[model samples]
Target: MAAGPNEPKSRYLQYLEVVTGSLEEKRRYRQYKARVKRLPENYRTAVEALERYLMHFGPADGAGAMSMYEDLADLFEQSVADGTPIRDIFGADPVEFVEAFMANYPAGQYRARERNRFTSAIQRAAGEDTGQDGTDR
Candidate 1:
């Protein structure tokens, strides 16, 4: 039977039951790793690092998630088309790449709370925020 508009799509529903450490989750992880292995080493590293960053700070909404993925994919495709080496593009600095990517989004595109939290986390990581109160010590 075809799913109704209100019903979850099959591809999305497949992940709904994925439990951490479950066989299904492990299978998905393995598949992802195998696919990533086919990319050039430098590109592979950059992609993996970006994945990690997004896992930590990605959007919660479907629209935001889709937009983020599309933007990142476009950036990677454009870089490849320009004949830029991945290592040279990311420059052995995942944080710098992340910062540059984040800069592309205008302020307030994300939820205010999430945006503030992400900004604070980045500031702390950069050693720009020395105190819990958000003031330099």
Candidate 2:
């Protein structure tokens, strides 16, 4: 998955790829593990929670994870309402949504290390907000 200009090495993006029915998902999961292992301890916890979320809930875990991801969706909706022309949610364009979600999440220690993520998500959203897709405005 290509990490966009203002995106991070996202666990969410990694998660979405593995959750899909793609045949090579196992290999991706291996790379995903390597990626997870390198994250800071705090981020490791979120990745772990995400794993538990996936393992226990199956493909439907996204339903639950949304509590973790929904605010970002809401943020975009608010932006869209205000003439921000972006249209995306959850795993859709996860690079954009994950950063927004992480930036706003009240829990986790990634706040400091995720500075780039927060800023980039905003810029990406702002870029999409310009009615390029005719969905935001």
Candidate 3:
């Protein structure tokens, strides 16, 4: 996450700072809340529900989480403009919809690391020498 001396800070880095709960982050979060509040009631409720679910189960990384939240806001705002129904947005399965949405934000998923670790551990236990690409050598 460290930036080089000559490199400009990226938006992702800015988001990581937001996760650290800086004053600027607080202001941005408040602005985000205000935007959500201005949405029509149904869209507002849907966003709230999705926010709650995402907060619990979405990206573990601060940058990824904030990015996801920002995207969520953008999505509903556009949907409001397009007159999209809730059912049309998420379809028959809300969990499935959320999972699909989460796929776009992989940085926060600690489970990916765990899955790789588990695979490596099993290979070691089985006395397998894996190549750099993770194939058995």
Best by TM-score: 3
Per-residue lDDT for 9-43 in model 1, tens only? 47545555353223334454555566556666776
Against the true structure, what is each candidate's TM-score?
Answer: 0.47, 0.28, 0.69
**Candidate that beats the other on TM-score, 1 or 3, i.e. the better one:** 3
Candidate 2: where are CA atoms >4 Å away? 1-23, 60-137
RMSD score of candidate 3 (Å): 6.5
| C-alpha lDDT score of every prediction, in listed order | 0.62, 0.48, 0.82
What lDDT would candidate 3 get against the real structure? 0.82
Candidates 2 and 3 compared: the better one by lDDT is: 3
At residue 89, candidate 3 shows an lDDT of 96
Candidate with better TM-score, 2 vs 3 = 3
Question: Per-residue lDDT of 4-103 in model 2, one digit per residue for the tens?
Answer: 7577747866777677743244454555566556655644554555456445432333333344433323444355456543333335564554455444
Question: How many pairs of residues collide in model 1?
Answer: 0
Q: For model 2, what is the error of residue 3's alpha carbon versus the real structure, in angstroms, after optimal superposition?
A: 27
Clashing residue pair totals per candidate (backbone < 3 A): 0, 2, 1
